[model samples]
Target: MYIITDQLKENGFSVNRLDQIIKRNNNKRQFNTLEYFCIYIIMENIGLIVENTSYNITAGNIVFLGPQKSIEFGKAKGQDTFIISFSSSFYERSIKDSLFLNSQLFFNYNSDIFIAPFSNIEEMRVVFMDRMENFRKKDKSLYLSAAHNAIERLILDAFLHIPTEEVKKDIKFDYLYCVNKFKVVLQRDYKTAKKVSHYAGELNVTPRKLTEMTEYVLGKSAKHVIIEKLISESKKMLSYTNYTISQIAFELGFSDEGNFTNFFKKHTQKNPSEMR
Candidate 1:
């Protein structure tokens, strides 16, 4: 709901060296509720802290962040990066698929696959520079086609490198695909749909197959993914809202306040009251 696309209306795209962007915005309030898909390719070593996790950014490592995620600049010196940002509107216009964000390349906020290392750092720098120049030109109509292709190439590059089992025998591309689809489905139905079979029915796969796919690709079962997603939302509500525990329990589809507290404590190892 936080529309960051407003700053990108100049060309529906924005590219900047990370140091410059950081220097220009030196305010203490640095956490962003971004509304655009953003890619940050580290040109130098840096540490990126996001919520409860921190990523060690080295040269050639690119971080892909989806909209609505919170991020913070970690304590580091001489950090350099090339950042490319574009609105979902721009992405849909160019790609012709409004639901493209459902893909594993875009979402899956729970996974460590957000960062991937690329060998051709210099070549990528050239590619990003060329795209930036396209945004600068006045008559940019001609650049649209070229820019679209370039963006797709970059996106494809990121998708191809998502971490999977190294043993080719264990790598089932269909399972991977199904797991990603399951992620999208879980995001849409996690609140109302609790059973593994419920999601398996939606994906047209058996509950066992879905669990295997999730374990293989994400090191967790389908039920674990659902519970994690629900608990994540519960924590957000607990931290940000004035809703009472009973109200939150009812909203989250819990049978009762005690049941919600037990479920929360089982996963988080702390009661909801302690969290608040």
Candidate 2:
């Protein structure tokens, strides 16, 4: 469900009644969303298709989504969920905590985090219910502070529940810190920054070092990552928009239509037209 923008402006965040939202908007086979970081506490089975990955959500499950991450609902009925959504600005203003948000849970590339049946489930449920009641009361001072605290508590609980191995995994490849940051850089500038050296320069690493870190972390070289991102975007535009190949090519920073066609065919082994 989408965050109601007006409520967010007034309260720095918003909580959606998840069952109501699904009832109102679940007519479609897929509901693709591209806004807000979302946290879902599930009271029953709820399935989700996020990007290309599928998640089976069940009772006592907590699902976290990053901003601009696309997701579609999977078919399951009789589910009750509490969905908390907030903007990056609001979250920062309320808690001043980006560390956990940037950890494996929230904003990492190609990853989403979910927790199942934590020790503080009842505590979290109480906080969520209390926050909802206060929110319905429309007492700004009361609800806003409570809502912020409730969300912060949920985040802390999530951090506490994270597995020891996950922490060790992150520490093992300390270069992963650089790799994740490099991913952010690539995501922001992939269209214009085509060369590995360009991304390496932005991340203040040598091209070879960048490739090595990326391969170590992602199992692909830096150049493959950049090219794959471009190809993925191209596929999206080709499938979803009416833009011609030439238009898509120019829009994606290729010098010419022929160059774009060659790249697409080289990667996909099919012309863009054939794919479309």
Candidate 3:
């Protein structure tokens, strides 16, 4: 796939066509967990596995994937699928932007992937094409900002068109809002602050109320959410990095390696080294 923007940078945006990526890997199914968020626009029927769940995607469909979700793409030859990806640091330049990214439109704690149909496929394609052109201009003044605006437009458009039925009608909006905010805070502080009370303090709510809100919206307790985040990050590190178990434990804010090991094995039924 042709990358419209540089991929070597720490924080950046990129646009890629899926055909070349699949072909480059010998047309075999590819599995990955990206460190950044992604929006996939499908121009043909294809299969995708997100978080181990299979989905058959058709033409005119758009898929959103948050960071650290495992994804497997099925083979598709000559399909006009395109992906737009960006890092949190690249997109969340302000509090408003951060909250927007954490909104249900992009980040849903109960689900790692969100799929919707794009009724105006041609118009969406035009916007993506223009964005690719803008990102190609590395020397242009405010080129990155232009790219940001384009992506924001795409996200906002998706937000406006998301199917109402996808959301649970029984849940109250306040609980949904609180859970969304809790997710944002949990993601930001999971490395240093793993306690539910700490997260409640951050959101200016009682720990009991926070747990109730999380249960109401995500069908899990607030503490469960924190543990899930920890396990997810731990697996990524073990599978992708060369860090020793002790080092990883320290990095994740555990008091000691033994405690980390016990915790990991208790939850995942495997040692960190075995996972690696």
Candidate 4:
């Protein structure tokens, strides 16, 4: 597994081999880091446990581990694998364009990694592995920026092939409706009210109804959904954009910047700049 404690390390990153820590399952051995992201291609035989999440990475598929994430994995069963790490800056200049976002072939809304099927992965991996090899070889002409861009393109191609999960027709309507509606209102006013009652009033529903609806749709309370979306959006802005604290607060519609800072600090422990 790869972990980056700092956003931009010298020559780009620092990685440590995590051997038996995960097999033992002790909670104390956590690898903490600053804002960063990593990608891994694992054989089906190997496995990983990230914090409380357990997953297996089959060949031709990609998995992502983001900053401040602690994880553990096993050795490969047969074929070789890959692990690439980079700062967010790598993404902005390479994969952050609107074309990449709309490329559908390499993007998804609900999940971080977009998995491609074997046929597509096979075709893509040839070109991808070539670039990977060039970076690994550390040729004198190779630059850190070029290496990051190649890896980013590979990630996007993998995502493009992953289709959105078909929403089950039999799923509960109360849940689906609430989640969609909540997203609509949330994007409009996440920073202003961010209270259950505020959203409930807009929907003309009672707080109890709002809670029940949210639980049905998202397995969470209305308040939790609001907090999660706001906090997540706040972090995305704080990390990806160069906006100042007050400008961010004002844009998000906070009455004042102090309220926004307090709200963010309450959830994340670190203030905005500290997060950066």
Candidate 5:
């Protein structure tokens, strides 16, 4: 199931009952909830934007979205096509994780990616379309929750094994892209790591490039950002959870409590114990 668009609404975000063909004349006219999660199952064809990324989604392909994603355009293709959207009111977290991870190749504008070709595409399409059809007809015999869960698992199971990594090599990419690469390398090697050289090496870029991107985009050095993220997560554990200081230390890649404490103090101006 592909979802798009979610906003705060009176009923915890209203939902649109989606099934059947949405005509081009009705395109851009918000049906269902303007501010709810959307699951888009395209059977025929539809080109739409999710989270700032454009998709020329094929018939029988699916995409899932979390929040603030939009779905514009109605399904209009030569062969019979079906597209379905599910709001978060019907969302499942495990499924959400699967959807988030599935998006790796595309540039994440506002949408993340999840797509799979089904052998029984037409049958699956009928099943989902029947859902909205039943909703319209008020199918008293169907147990709503059971039907929802079964479909959620069916779509996710096909697409949720492993995710592709984002492509990045040099500094001149998206601001978030560069920073995220720095974070990934930092977490991977933080146990035995440094200011900038350590991370830049893993990303195959120079320290100068790393520092420049971080400073320009974040108004702080990349070094400060890494230390801050580590310290921030550490503070949450120390203050919010009962994990031992040593445990938090090791989790953040500190070898010893003293090292952890000192590092935390340097960044946060408070000792771990005091923060706790």
Candidate 6:
């Protein structure tokens, strides 16, 4: 395990071996809500649940996760795996890098989990090893920059191997940028601003234009995006917290418990209590 953090702890990065992480957690499967972007390299078969979806990952597989996602690990005894986690502030050196991070390559709102097989497992290992070496450096002068470069290399390598068709070529970068900004704003104001018009007002675009942008880039309506985010947050709270259904509703800015129940059941086909 190698952990490097800034003084404020807002910008930090870490690399840890799978076995060590499990051992540190009393050898139990771990459930985590990531606060940073993460890359998981699996050298053995494993099961993973990302935001309520299960995936079977085998050797040579890599998983990418954006921030605020819930992930549960399955057993992988004697398996070799490495987890690299870094905050956005730690990784973003320029506006281009920030936009790249928000791109579909990493933070795709349409997908819960992104997995791809490494074309060259040894080469991937070398990248992680280099990052670890940078963390081990004592001089500490160029370590942060070197680590950033290593992460950039890893992302670009993954981009190359990910199927070209998976990339959204039809959507221009401007639309993608607007859609990404909408997502960021949606995440920040989901509780208070549940309506599409509110988001459009915040983004300085008309509601119809927002919907057009979201549809162009994500193939989903802006309203659907907002509701999806609300549902996701609702599920997270129900699954991970002891809050009652009514409290959860209030927290999510619902007018009343009954309204929330109707909305939840309409979308999920289950009551909030049933989900809990």
For model 1, give the 10-residue run with minimal summed lDDT.
94-103
- Residue-pair clashes per prediction, in order, are 0, 0, 0, 6, 24, 0
lDDT to native, each model: 0.69, 0.70, 0.74, 0.57, 0.53, 0.74
lDDT of 6: 0.74
lDDT of 4 by residue, 75-172 (tens): 55323444556554545453243233233332223533344534455554444456545665785235555665666566565655545453243455
lDDT of 2 by residue, 1-276 (tens): 443457866655777656555665645434433445678787767777665456787777777766555566665553356778876566665223555555566654445445545555566566787657866698777787777677777777777766765553343234665676676666567778899999899888899999998887677999998988888889878887789999999989999999999999999999999977
lDDT per residue, candidate 5, 1-276, as tens digits?
Answer: 223333223223222334322433342323332323345555566776542245787766655543333445544542354333444454435634334322332223222455655656767655655554565367523435444554556555544433433322232334545664565456445556756887888877888888887786456887886776576568667866788999888777777989988888887788788875
Point out the worst 10-residue segment of candidate 5 by lDDT.
7-16
State the TM-score for model 1: 0.60
Superposition-based RMSD of candidate 2 using all C-alpha atoms, in angstroms:
6.2
Better of 2 and 4 by lDDT: 2
Please identify which of the two predictions, 3 or 5, would achieve the higher TM-score against the true structure.
3
Task: Compute the lDDT of residue 221 as modeled in candidate 6.
Answer: 98
Residue 7 displacement in candidate 3 (angstroms): 3.2
> What are the models' TM-scores?
0.60, 0.62, 0.60, 0.43, 0.40, 0.69
TM-score of 4: 0.43
Over 72-184, each residue of candidate 3 has an lDDT whose tens digit, in order, gives: 78767635788777877888877557655666656765566777677777776777766556656654446567768877876776776656665464557567657876776
User: What is the Cα-based lDDT of residue 136 in candidate 3?
Assistant: 61
Cα deviation at 179, candidate 6, in Å, is 3.4
**Model 4 CA deviation exceeding 4 Å by range:** 1-8, 13-34, 75-79, 94-141, 162-222, 226-276
| CA lDDT, candidate 3, residue 28 | 55
Provide the lDDT at 238 for model 6: 92
Better of 2 and 3 by TM-score: 2
Score candidate 2 by lDDT: 0.70
Score candidate 3 by lDDT: 0.74
Per-residue C-alpha lDDT of model 6 across residues 78-172, encoded as one tens digit per residue: 34788778877788778667656766556766576667677677776766766556565754546666667767866776777656676765556
Span of ten consecutive residues with least summed lDDT in model 6: 1-10
| Best prediction by TM-score | 6
Model 3 poorest 10 in a row by lDDT: 1-10
